[model samples]
Target: MTAPAAPEVLRHVDALAEVVGRQHVLVGEQVPARHVQDLWGSDRKGVASVVVCPGTPAEVARVLRLCAEHRQPVVVQGGMTGLVSGGVPGPEEVVLSTERLDSIGEIDPAIATVTAGAGVTLADLQDEAARHGLVVPIDLASKGSATIGGCVATNAGGVNVVGYGMTRQHVRSLQVALADGRLLELSTPLVKDNAGFDLKQLFIGSEGTLGVVTAATLALRQAPRTRTGVFCAVADVAGALELLTAIRAQLPGMLTAFEVVWADAYAVLDGLDLRLPLPMGYPVYVLAEVQGGRPEADSEALLACLASIEHVLLDSAVADTAAELAVFWQARERIPSEILRMQPLFGFDVSVSARDLQDCLERMRAELTERWPQVKLLVFGHLGDDNVHIAVVTGEQTRKRKAEVEHIVYGCVSRSSGSISAEHGIGFEKRPYLGYTRSPEEMELMRSLKALLDPAGILNRGRVLTWGNETDPA
Candidate 1:
C-alpha cells in the first residue's frame, strides 16, 4: 500500500471542505479538544488532519467518495460520547462528524414510527416523542449528548432495556453510505415486512465499520401515562432475582426498568448530595420502575408488592411523587460520572445469565481482591437484563494493572459463558478480549464482512476489529 503524498492530502482536504463548506471543516488546531477525546481516556489532541461536518447524507456520501479517491482513512463521529475508542481518529485520518445532520423528520403516529437524522440526540428524540404521546424506548445516561446514530451503531442498552430492549430493537431501518460512497435505503418503519433479508441489522451494532448510518426510521412505543419508581434493598442476588420475577409477573408491561447497585456502588452514591430512600447500607439495592396509568395507585401497588416480600428485602422505599421518582433515578444515572470521581478507575459492562451472575461476581471479586489487595470494585447496572457495570478503583492505574484486571474480569465472564460486552460494542479497547467471547470462526466471519463492505479498510480503520500491521486483517 503506497502512502498518499502531501499534495494528495492537501487535495483531499480541499475537496472535503468544498463538499461540506469551508466553515464546517476543521484541521489541526481548529478541532475542539472535546472532539479529540471520547467519553473516557486521554484526548487525541492532534491526531486527525481534518474534521468535516456534513449537513446532509448527500454531502456525507460526497465526502466519503472524495476520501476513498484520495485513499485517506475516515473516522465517523456522532456525539463523541462513546465509551470505546471507536470514534477516535488517527493522525493521517479525517473525521466525518454527524453533528450537522441533526434534523427530526416525520413522526408518523399511524405507523408508530419516527424518522430522525443521525445527529439527533436521544434527549431531543424523547422530547419530540412526548409531544406526540409516543416514545423512542432506548435510553442511556448520556442521552443528552449521545446521538441516535451512535446508539444504533453500538446497539446501546440502558436502564429500560429489560422492558423496551436495546437500540437494535427500537431501530426499524437505516439509511447508510457504503465504502464506495453509494447510498442505500434499507427499509421502512413498517411493523410487518417479510422481506428477503434485514440488512439494516448489520449496521445497527457494527460500530461504523460496515457503513455510515446517516438517518434511521425507529419504532416507537406508546408513552405511558404514569411512571413510578421504587428504591429498595435485597438480601442477595437471589432475592434480587426473585423480586424481578415477582414484579414482572405482577406488573407485566408496567415494569419498565429493574436496576441493581451493589453495596460498593451505593457507597459512592451516598457521598452525593441527594436523599437516600433507604439508609445506604445493604448487600444489594434495586431501582425498579413501573410505567402505566394512575401513578398514585401504581405506587401503592408496588409498595404492597414490596411489603409482601418483606422477608426478602432488608429495607425499602417507594416514590409516589414525580420529585421522589426523579431522586431515585438520579442516583442510578449518576453512577457513570460519579465513579470517575474515584481516581484511577476502570469501568466495564458485561452480561451473564441470571443463574450464573452471582457466582461470576463472587469469583471476579475474590480474584480481583486477591490480585489487588487495596482495589475497590463498584458494581451496578440493569440486572433485569443480566447486564452489570463494574468500576474498578485501584491505587495503581498502570497499564499493566489495567490489563491484569481486564484479564481477570473477562476471564470470569468467559468461564460463565457470558459476553465480554453486553451493549457496548468491542471497540479498539476491548478488541483483544473478543476471542474470550467469540469463537475463531466468528472473528473470521466478521473480517469477511468488513472486507466486503469496506474493502479499502478506510472507514474507522482500526476499530472493533483491527487489520494486519494497520493494513490487513489481524
Candidate 2:
C-alpha cells in the first residue's frame, strides 16, 4: 500500500524517456491500467515507472540496456491474452509493450516459411498466409488478440492439436534479444541442423524469463483443400477417448481436432448470454474435425471415419454448411466465455496422459460432487492433446467454496503427475501446485536456470520459477 520513493522512480523514468523519446516513454496518470496484468484474475496490476514501446529490435535492445543501467525490473506484454499472471507488472517496474513493432518479413514459397515480428497478432499472420494460399495450423482461441511472440513464448495449443502440434513444433527459428543488449539472430530455414546445440529451443517456452523474443521465422503448412466438422454425442469420457482413437486409426492424417464437452457445462451457458447450436441432452459431446489435401477425397474419408466409430450413440442432423460449423465451434467457445461471464470460477488448464484422462476426470468429478452437491462442474478440452479445461463454478461472493474446490482439484491433478498448466504458461495461479507435476530435482534445476538467466530475478519476476525462494520443494 506504500508508493515508491518519488525521486529515484522519477529519475529512472527520465532516463528511459531519454533513450526511447518522451512520446514512447509513458508515465503519470496517462498510463492505462490495461498494461498491468494478463487474462487471469489477479491484483498484480501496478503503474509502471515508465512504459517503453520500441519500434525495432535494435530500439528494444537499447531500451533494455538503459533499463539495465537503471537496474529497474521490467515486464514484457504482448496482446495480454495469457491465462497466467506472468505478464503482470509491479510497482516501480517498467513495461515493454510490443505494440508498435509490427512488421512482416519474407515469405518463402518453396519452404513455406514466413518471418514476422513478435508484435504481429495471430489474425494478421493468418490473413497474410491466406493471401499466399497457405495456413498456419497452430490456432488458439486468443488468436484474435494474442501476439506471435506470446504464442511462441507460451507454445500455445489450440483446437487443431489433433493434427498440427503446438506452436513450438511449428516454429523453425527464433530471433531473441537478451536482457543485457545482446541480439541473437537465429533465423534458420534449414530443416536439418545439427549444430553444436539447439539454442533456440531454450527460449521457446521460458515465458520470457531467459530473453525477450523479438521476431521469429515460422513454418507454414499448405492450406487444406477440404475440411469437415462433426458434432457427435458420447456417453462418457472413456467413450469419447475410444471414439477418438478409433477415428484416428481410421482417418490417420485426416483427423484434425477431437474436443469433448460435459453435458453439465451446458448448464453454465443456460440463462447466460452464451448460445449453442447443438441440442443439450447428451451426457457428453464431441466436436471433431478432419482436413485433407484433397477436397472430395478427404470428405469421403472423413465420412468413413465418422461411420466407423462405434461409440457414437446418435449422429443425425449433420450440417454441412458453414453456418453449421460456426454453430459447433460456438458451443465449445461458449463454455469458457460463459465461465468468465457467470462468476468467479476456480479453473484449471491441466493435462494428464491420454490413457489417464478418463481416470483423472472421473476421480475429480466425483470428489467435487460430494463436496458441493449443488455445484455445477463443467469440463471441456482439446482431447487430441490430452489437455483439459475444468471449471468448478463458485459464486464470487463466497471465497470458501472456491478455496475448498481448488485444494481438492489440484491435489488430484498433482497425484496424476499431470502438468498444472498445458498451453497456458504457468503464471501465479498454479505456482503453489507446481510440485504436483514436477519432481523436486526438476524444480531445483528450473530455479538454477532462473538464477543463471535472470541473476537479479527481475524478468517475469514471480512466474514459472517460483520455487526458488517463494516455494518449498517437497
Candidate 3:
C-alpha cells in the first residue's frame, strides 16, 4: 500500500490532468508496475509522483511546461520495453506515458515514408507498412511492445541492421517536446534536406535526455518478393566471420541478416526441449538471410555462396519455407529466455570491430571462466553490425558481484575500443560505464548539450548524464 501524495504534488497532478484529462492521470497505487520496472528485471523499482498520459503533442507540451514551472523532474516512457532503465522514473518523479499517442498516419508511397505517433509499436508500424507493399527496416525482438518513440530514442539496431540500418537511418524527421514545453519540429520529409543542421539526429540516440520524442516520419523500403535464410554451424567466431566475408563478397546486397550464436547458447534449446536445427557440438552457429525478387534465384545464390565456404562450416540447415525460417529464428531468439531461467544473470549488449570481436570474447571468456569456474556464459548477436549480446550466470550472488562482472566485460570492450552499449543507450544501468567508451571531452560535450536544451535537468533526470553527487538508487 502507498501513502497519499503531498498537497503540492496533488496540485501539480491536477494541473497536468487539466491538459490531458483526470482519467488519464494515475497516482500512487493507480500507477502500474510496468511503468516503474525495466525489462532487465532489476529489483530496484521507481516511485512515480504521478503518471500522466497525453494524447497529442500539444498536450505533451503543456504537461512539460507545467512540470518545468514547478521544477518537477519528468521521466518520459514509451512502451517501457527498454532493457536499460532509461524509461524508469525516479522517486517522486512525474512519469509522462506516451501510450495514448497511438495514432498512425497514412503511408506515403510516393516518398516511402510513414508518420506515426510515439506510442505506436514497431510491429504495428511494420504491419501497416506491409499493407502498402513497403517495410520498416528496423526490426527487434521487442517489436510487438517497443514503440517507435523508444526505438528512435535508443536508435535501436536489430537483426536487419546488416541489410537496412539502425533506427537512426530510418528516421527522417522527429517531433520532440522539449523540457521547457516547446514543441520542436526537427525536420521535413524531404529525402535530402541539407539546408541546415539535421537536428533530429541529436534526439535519435539521445535516450530521451534532451527532449521527448512525440512522433516521427520513418523512411521505408519496398518489400522483398522473396526471402531465404540458412542456419549454419561454424567452427568458431573467426570461421563465422570468414563465412560472413564470403557471403558478402558473393551475394552482395542481397544479404539481410548475419547472426551468430555460440554453442553454449544454442544448447539452451535442449534444456527447453525445443527442436534443434543441428547438433549442439559445434562451437558457433550462424543464421544468414537474403532477400531478392526471385525466390529460386535467391535460394540458389545463398546455397551456392555457402557451398563455396563449406570448409569453414561444420554443418548447415536451409530455411526455404516461411515455417522453416521461423523455426530457425525461434531457436536463436529463445536463447535469452532459456539462459535467463537461472537464478541470477547479467546481460550485456556491446559492439566491437569485426577484427577484434573474436579476441575480445576469448579474453572475456577466459577471465570469467578462471574467476568463476561454474559460470555460464551465453553469447550471440548481429555479426554483420559488430554487436554482441552476452548473458552471464556465475552461480553466485549477482547483485553483489555485478560490478566485478561488468569490470571484466567492459574492460575488454574498452581496451578493444568498442562501445559498452552497442544499441541500448546509457541508462541508469550503464551510467557508471559511460567513460569506458567515451572520453572526458566527448562526455563533456554531451553534458553541454544537455544543459543547453534541458537547463533545468527536468527531463529524464539522472539518465545518460548523471546529476551532481547523485548515485544509483538502492
Candidate 4:
C-alpha cells in the first residue's frame, strides 16, 4: 500500500490544529462527502481528500501557505449553495470550507457600512443590518443558505438589481487571502478610489480562481421607513417594460424593485397555487415594489402609477403591512424554489437591453415552445435590469437532456447578445458557453489575468476558463 505523501500539508494542518484545535479539521474519510460540492448536487470530478474549516483570516492564510509550499490545489467553499460546480472538491485537493469563518464583525450605522466575515449567511447579515436600521440591497432568494462570500464571489443579482444593483456594486472593499498566503487587507469602505487598479474586483465573480474571499466591507442603504409592493398583471414583457418606465417616470420615489414574470412561469405559479390574489389571465406579471421614507406617500404613488399603465389593464394587489409584503414577495421567491424541485431544471440567467428584452424573450420562448413543446419552461426574474432566469424543466435528470436544454438556451443567448450567466458565476457549468458572452480578445484578457494571478493553475481548476492545466495535486 502506498502511504500518503502529505508531509508538508500535515505539518501545517498540525500547526493550524494547535491554534484552532483538531476538531475543525476533517482529514481522510472524516471529511463529509456532502461538503465537497455546491447546490448543483453531484459528484465532482475532483473531490478533496481532506476538508479544513478555518475560523479566521490567520487560519485561512496559514492553510494557503501550506498548500503553496507543497504546491497543492485548494478549493474554497461557502454554504455549498452555489449552482455552479466550482465548489466541488477534487480527489487530491483540499477543501477550505468557510463554515468556521462565520462572523458579523460590525455594523456601522453612522456610515452605513457592514464589515462581515465571508462565511456569514445572507440572512444573518440582513438581520444584523436591520438591527442597525440599514439594508444591504443585494437580496437573493438563497439568503437563508447563501453566504456573503458566495454572493460576492458571483457578484449576485436578485430582484433588487433593478433598483440597488449587484453584489459587486454594493461591495465597497474585499478582504481576500491569495493562493500564496498573502493576506490582501482591502476592506477599505471608501466610496471612490481611483488611485490605481481596483483590486477588489480581482476576486469578485472569479469563482475562487485567483483567491479566497475572507471578509468584505459592504455598502449599505438606509433602511426604508416604508415600502409599498404591487403584484400586478401586465399584457406582456413589453407592457411590463412600459409599466416600469411610466411608474419610474411618474412615481420614482416608490420604484425600488420592478420584477416581471413570463406567463409561462406565472402559469406554473398558478398550477402550484402560489398565485397572487389578483386574477392571473395576463401574458405577464410584474411584481413592482416601491420604497420611500414616508409610507403614506409611497403607497399613494404606487396606486397612482398603477392607474397610468393604460396599455395593460393592470389589476394590482397592494401589500399593506410587513406580513402582507412578505406574502407578496413569496409569490416571486417560491417560483425558483418550487421549480428547482422538478428534476434538475436548466436555469439560464441572462441579461439584455430592456427594449430588446421583449424581443429576446419572445424569440427564446417561441423557439423553445416550438421545438420542445412538451418541455416545461419557467421564466421569471428582475425585469428592472433586463435579467431573466429561464428554467427549462426536463422530467428526465440525465446529463444528455440537461446538455440539450443548455445548448438550445445558450444558442439563443449568443444570438440575442445576452449574457450567458448573469448572477451565477461562469463556474464549470457555464464554462463552455462563456464564448457566447465573451469575445476571443476579451477571453484572452481573462486568461491572461488568470495565468498571472494563479501561474501554478492551483485556484479552483476547471472553472471560469475552458482550458487550463490542472494544478499540483494535494
Top-TM-score candidate index: 3
Who wins the lDDT comparison? 3
Which candidate, 3 or 4, would have the higher lDDT against the true structure? Answer: 3
Model 1's alpha-carbon lDDT is: 0.83
Backbone clashes (count) for model 1: 2
For model 3, residues 350-461, the per-residue Cα lDDT tens digits are 9999899889988998999998998888899998999999888887875788888999999999999999999988888898889899998998999999999989898888
How do all models score by TM-score? 0.95, 0.93, 0.97, 0.91
Model 4 C-alpha lDDT per residue in residues 264-347, reported as the tens digit of each score = 776656666554656667777878888888758777877777777755756767888888888788787777766766766677
Give the range of the ten consecutive residues with the poorest summed lDDT in model 1: 1-10
In model 1, which residue pairs have backbone atoms overlapping below 3 Å? 467-472, 468-472
Per-prediction RMSD in angstroms?
3.0, 2.5, 1.7, 3.7
CA lDDT of every candidate:
0.83, 0.76, 0.88, 0.77
lDDT of 2 by residue, 1-474 (tens): 333434555677667677667888777566666676676555455555567888888888887776666666778888888877878776656788887778988677678988889999999999999888899878878788899999888888888887989898888888887777677877486788777677888888888888889998898988887767778887877777777887788777777788888887766666655446557788888888877777676667666766777546554334476677777887787678777754656777888887887778778878877876666667889888889888877534565555577667877877787888888888766666677788889978888877776677657777776633476332
Candidate 4 matches the true fold with a TM-score of 0.91
**2 against 3, candidate with superior TM-score:** 3
- Once superposed on the true structure, which residue ranges of model 2 sit more than 4 Å away at CA? 1-7, 271-275, 400-403, 467-469, 472-474
Q: After superposition, how far is residue 195 of candidate 4 from its true place, in Å?
A: 2.3
Query: Clashes per prediction?
Result: 2, 0, 0, 6
Assess the local accuracy of residue 200 in candidate 2 as a C-alpha lDDT between 0 and 100.
85
